[model samples]
Target: MAPVKKHGRRRASVSASELAQMGVCERLVVFEHRYGKRRTVEQQQAIKRGRRAHARFYREGHMDWTRWWRYFIVFLIFGRWLTLCVAKWFQVRKPHHET
Candidate 1:
């Protein structure tokens, strides 16, 4: 495709932030350009935002403990709640104890 036609090339402006994100994963830049998709719940999970935030509470400096707790609490409540709901649904639908 490249020899005959200049296709599949990104026209991204590739700003500093874009470059930084691309460093993590080029797909991020591509998705951002195509969908303008900002940070999502899944993305937060992938990056372990909750754990990262919670770490600050125990680290050397005791700054921003409130924010840390918020992150930890939200993920514990929402994330664990979602897991429990899915597990219950699967348990009801899944086959088991059959002859």
Candidate 2:
């Protein structure tokens, strides 16, 4: 009689870009992508943290925490107004359809 052998989970197809996004510490890209493993919130936050916190305000239409919090009391109000004005300046008029 022959003995049976057990096997672990098989590896999935993973790409290098995904591995870079995951910040794979060791040489384990496909393994991590296949298996249930993820980077901590703190780690991810630190890795790409604060870099674009204010990008929302800078880019317009997607405000997160309002990077320009130098003066939360009144400055933000004026700053928001100014930002809106600037955004409107570059706003492209989308054509209205009369269907």
The top-ranked prediction according to lDDT is 1
Instruction: State each model's CA lDDT, in order.
Output: 0.68, 0.58
Clash count, one per candidate: 0, 0
| Model 2, C-alpha of 24: deviation from truth (Å) | 8.2
lDDT of 2 by residue, 22-63 (tens): 584544645554564577999678657555765645667434
* Global local distance difference test of model 2: 0.58
TM-scores, each model vs. reference: 0.30, 0.25
lDDT of 1 by residue, 7-56 (tens): 75655454455557668887665766666766788976965865677686
Q: What is the lDDT of residue 75 in candidate 2?
A: 82
- Worst 10-residue lDDT window for candidate 2 reads 1-10
User: Candidate 2 at residue 26, lDDT?
Assistant: 47
Model 1 misplaced regions, further than 4 Å: 1-63, 95-99
Model 1, CA-based lDDT: 0.68
In model 1, pairs of residues that clash are: none
